[model samples]
Target: MTENLPFIEITDIIQSLANKRSTGTLELSRDGEPTTYLFFREGMIQHLKAPRSQVILGKALYQLNLIDEADYELTLSDYAQTGRRYGEVLAELGLVSEEGLRQALSFQAREDLQNVLTWKQVQTRFHGSSQPLSDVFSESDLEFELQMGGMSLLMEAARREDEWSLVREHIPHEDDVLRLSAPGAIKAEDLEVRITLLIDGYRSAYEIADAAPCNTLECLHQLAELVREGKLVTLEPLELIELGHEAELDDDHEKALKLYQLARSRGQDGFDLRRRIARAHHMLGHKQEALERWLEVAERCAEAERADLAIATLKEVIELYPTDLHLRQRLVPLLVANAAKADAALQLRNLIALAETNGESPQLLTDLMNQLLELDPSDRPTLKALATLHREEGDGVLAMGRLDELATLEVEADRLEEAILAYREILEIDPENLNARLRLAESYAGLGSTDDAVAEYRGLADILYNSGLIANSINWPFLIRVYESIVELEPSSTPAWEWLAKAYIENNQRDLAISRYLGMAQSLRPTPGEPPSPALISPLARVVELDPTRLEVCYELAHTYLALEMRVEAGRTLRQLAEEALRQEDVPKARSAYQEAIEIDPFDLVSRRGMAALHELQGDLDLAFGIWLLCAELCQRVGLLSEGRSDARRALAISASDPRALKVSAALEALAEEPQAAAALLLRYAEIMHERENSGLALEAIAQARRLDPARVARHPLLSLLSTGNTPRSGAPLR
Candidate 1:
């Protein structure tokens, strides 16, 4: 710093410090040595925290909650800015104010506040607080006390003086960014920068002059630049401020005059100083002695409260002299009703009432009235708001007593139904009001009301449904109990039956749902001892019983039995059902289903013929013949159809003699006459005759050809064809 300029003079900041208005921390320097400090509205230095540079950066950013380790590295990376204050960068970063930057620079300039404050009023140190800076610091806008000499000397001046309207700083680094510290600015390009090469730590500011050989002032100019950018920071050492003497004051005298005129003048705001004073007296066992002091505070606070300064006064009392009983008691109900803790508020209430005051003020009674209003809770719509409030405040037994009294009064007023309704309301609000449900049910039962009793039971069911703790085995039993009462009231209830079935299903008893329907199906059964004649099951009713799922159920069951070697039983059941379908004239179902049954027992000739006859009635000649052939083979195998195949054999024989059979025979013979590929011709005719169910016809055709021309018939393909005269037994034996 220039030796010609004096160090920073602290006398300049006395008034703002005393009034609790100026806040941000401080830094000072002297003789090129950096010192760090904090100035609070609370007056006493907050903390000297660290060296000037670190603390200055920390406190400024701390105001913005941005001083985490992350921001320091970010700022260093971008140290060059077109001319602007460090506080502008801080403002852009939203860390500090334009007014704050001016004050910081002015403090670093050792300026007078009246002079500093006057200069501020005369010229805008920063962009208007609201207009907010964007860029540019004008030379006309800033005038610094030139600290002439070397770089280090100028840095020293920047730190010590607390006066300057603006700053310009020079920074050295590998890469640079211009940081504007004003809140906002106008076209900032005219702002200037001075970049320097940082020398090794050993080099003094004089060496900077050597490095800048053509400019001796380069060192001084660099240091001046650094200061403007807020890179230089330090604090002047302190000698405490004197307010007034405490020695002559009487401890018990009137407070407003004595305390303010003497002790509080130096405090940032008197409340903070008064708190420490109260604490000292409190710790010294001067409770009654200090009562007079607390009374003055409470009186000041009460006056503030009456003037609607309640929030500030309350904060002062609570955060400061919190142990005062009169103050706490007066404030507790206000706090509680406003959503503060009730128990803490109550503790203060109880303690204050117990205090040994010689005589109470009307304020005390007024406090009691408010507290009582908060305490009473008043009445309610359904809940008796008072009782509900207490219950919610966690006094359940108290709630119960209130309800009991209500119930008694209701009974005396001959409102039994209302009393019952009240009880029901409780149960509605908390359905686990099992005692009420039981009492209500008994009341209904006393009046011989089954419907009311049933309603109570259903309410219990709703509870069980919600809780899910009803025992699994007993659920149906409970449902049945409700159902019995329901039916007792209305005998023809379909919904009751449905609910019972659903309950059975929920318990996984599928047979129960089907059993009732099955009994209906079976009641239509012919009498008890008679065989199940197909006539016994009505076609429509049987259709319903044998629903799609039931059809699948029986089909799957049969396959399972077949797989388990119970083929005969599977066949018996399937054939009977298929025959039943045929009697109903469901021809396709009878044909295919009986065919499948016959397939399960290849030896059952009757089963096979029964299938063939159904197919024939449906005009499926090929299918009829195929089933007939299977019956013939099965019968012949078991020797059952060798002679008596019932109408199936007769029908098959009749169809085999048809005129279409003759056409098949003719096609086979004409195709055999093609000599070049007689084998291919024979095979083609065989496929057609086979598809047409003329295997018998094809055999018979060979017999006819032999009768016409023996050599040709004998020479035809197939094992039976080679036997001439004696007809090789015709037709494939059906499977």
Candidate 2:
């Protein structure tokens, strides 16, 4: 005998007996359920006896048409009196032949095995009889003729197990009753007549299988098909409750609640039913219906004086919604009404703590905390709340003491932000509380508030510095590390960068100081369209001071100067950048630097000359002449006539016949009031244009020369061509 084996072990027990060729009866049983027996002869199944719910042999024989209903009833009565098997009685009366008896017996054994396989747990016992098959039951009983191979029956059971999963989708449970959805809608061929006759809205699928001609799996499959076709459906209320129970057993609370709610809509109601529904809702997660149902059950149980039940129900809800202040408050009074003083006090304490932390109104929280304190004066959470109230009321001296205590508690609880806030309050009450500030800083750093932490650290450093720690260099390294963190958090913090740099220098790591500044400047590269950052200035300037040949650094420094409206300094920096770039033979870099310098101060003659020289080096004569002319124009505008004349001469030297150069040169000479020199330049300009067939331009130039010096223009050779109307393709009109 084997006890408490898993349901799957039935197959192993059957196979082991078959392999051993043991002749015995295997009894399968579960607690609170009927036992099933399988009789084997030479390891082949010959007979089975299962519960009436699982197998009704006479009804199965009648349903399979092996015997008529009359024959089934007649044989059952005769077999009872004759002390013979029902099938043997049927065969004796010729109601069912011997072959029919064997077939019915085979069907019974298959049904029994299938049902046994579906059970979740079982106990088994094998009684080895050691008797011949004919002697086990008399030859007249015909048990010897009804043998089935054990392995083949087990294989059939396995197939049914697989198909049961699919059949279960529509017919969720075997005990679920199925009925015609609309009697007129069901056609004759849609379902077998025998099965249809059993669908009286009262019989379960398992019962229908026993009373129908088909096996259990086939009957279930047919019912599922009818369900899918909408010709049949599981009966409501009863079937829903059954399914709910099944789901509940499976711990599928959501499905159980759905099915139970469906049953309630169909008029299934009771106190226990509603309580079960409430529990399902609670397990599935709350809906308003679930909450109301739970509340109703709790109230009913409380009125019934079932305090334990009521308390347990409320406790379940509270566990799910711990911070629900109203729920906790309600639970507290319920515990008190139940005379559970210890539990009541614990709940009250929890309520007070929750109110304090759950952002309840200040008045309500104050009342709760005061009540808790009255009962238990040493409650830490209540004390913390009172201290917070004192701080808010501006009782600083009293608040400071409470806040220090609160901060320590919060730190131990690992609530770093709360601890930081408490420490901040302490510092507010006593601004020079270095200990509080230090704790606050450390907590801030722990919570990733690096900038805030560094700010507090700097405050501490300042307090110490004013106390003359800096004179002895006692905390200089501390000062350095603090500033390093500050800059690390915000690389572009100007003051932090300066402090770090100075700290590095005092530590005699000047190169490291320079590297830090350089790193800072690199991090501050300005995005396009954004205003230049002020923080970029000192770092870039420092880096430039360390190595002036850092042209890119110098270039950014120049832009920062321009942003600050320091035009002279910007121009100076750009010039330095251009000189350095030129020394490196980077013509493009030098050109850009000079271009920026000229943009900052349009009349910067030195940058203009440098740009002009770079253009000349790059074989760009036109650009060179243009820059020279622009320089001369700027000089004239600024009242530097000699400088203007020199720039103009430079332009003419680049392109002797270029009209723009000649015009600029003439203008500069006129600005210097040298009429002859101006006239000569204009005449030269006119001659070059006339030779290029630009007679109109030439005539305009001659007109300008005449304005400068009329006598010199009259002596020009172009004047004779203008008089002859031999002006090229276009006639010229002198202005």
Write one digit per residue (lDDT tens) for candidate 1, span 1-735.
101212324433433343443433433334433332333334332222223231233333433344443554455444554544355566688655655554444333322212222222121111112211213223423343222122233344454332221222342211122223333321224222221433322223334433332222333454446445565321111111011122113242222223333334333344444544454455455666455554455556555554223334444545555555666665654455445655534554454344424335434533443354355322122234334544555666555545544554565665566556656656645568766676665455444555676677567666666778663333336667777577557544545644554444444566665553343334334455544433223322333343534543355445544655678867765676666666667776666667788688766666777766666676777877765554444444444432333333354365644443333333333333423233333333443454465566456544555554566545545425333323334454312
lDDT of 1: 0.44
Candidate 2 deviant stretches above 4 angstroms: 1-8, 23-27, 34-42, 47-53, 73-85, 88-92, 125-129, 132-142, 235-735
Model 2, 315-427: lDDT tens digits are: 88778667777776767777767667678768878887777677777778666666655555545666666778876776677667767877877888888988988898788
User: What TM-score should be assigned to candidate 2?
Assistant: 0.33
Alpha-carbon RMSD of each model: 26.6, 24.3
Determine which window of 10 residues in candidate 1 has minimal summed lDDT: 235-244
Top model number, TM-score: 2
Error of 2 at 385 (Å): 48
Task: Give the least accurate 10-residue stretch of model 2, judged by summed lDDT.
Answer: 132-141
Model 1 stretches with alpha carbons more than 4 Å out: 1-110, 113-115, 119-491, 503-735
